[model samples]
Target: MPFSFPTGAARFVAATACALALTSLVGCSNGEGGGGDSTTESATSPSKSGGTQVTINDFKFQPASLTVSPGAKVTVVNNDTTTHTLTASKGGSFDTGDIDPGKSATFTAPSKPGDFPYTCTIHPLMKGTLTVE
Candidate 1:
């Protein structure tokens, strides 16, 4: 028996197939509401925009959490290709409805001091926390 290497076209086909298979395996999903699969970004982490903004990208919250003073004007920027929202999960305290791709929305942080968890109404699995100080 003899062994031969794949030709250039054959190698290209194999590489492409592998690439596509990997892409599908890791494609982002607008997941259903569930336990957060994300980590809360510390209060000291760099802010997205002037310390009053959060970003939505790759089907996840950029910080996955935030801290701000009460009644702060927080901006939600949707950098993902799809629409998203940052909505309060508990008491409907805040919601940035249907932030389209490249669009932004602003909501006031609750006047009360506490931890307010939020999620994307469209993809609830994407969750975050907002701390009102």
Candidate 2:
């Protein structure tokens, strides 16, 4: 005898598999889908003299890495559903305290040129790097 599922079990399994495959495809499509890329940024323009914007979504910084002019103002926007912080790692420089959902904060870049690491104090796993030049 052959093994078989209940009346609707086979259909359900098929539908589930299809859904999972589609979800996987979407997640791998672009930087907007899933949180895979470690150095992704959503900034469409360069870090000008005014400021650069970084978006936080999906519990991760949209642009995980950025390069800006020295003393430039970096704006961090939290688009996620939870609060997050853009705190400098190892007490390097600036920290944006408790950025609520849909809110934003600004921090001035270091006057020197170097790589500065930052993370979310609330979610330590969320990390980012800022390069001042």
lDDT of 2 by residue, 33-69 (tens): 3455434552433444457877888767768888888
Highest lDDT scorer: 1
TM-score of 2: 0.65
lDDT of 1: 0.80
**Highest TM-score model number:** 1
Candidate RMSDs in Å, in order, are 6.3, 8.3
Output the TM-score of candidate 1.
Answer: 0.69
Task: Tell me the spans in candidate 1 whose CA falls farther than 4 Å from its real position.
Answer: 1-38, 44-51
In model 1, the clashing pairs are none
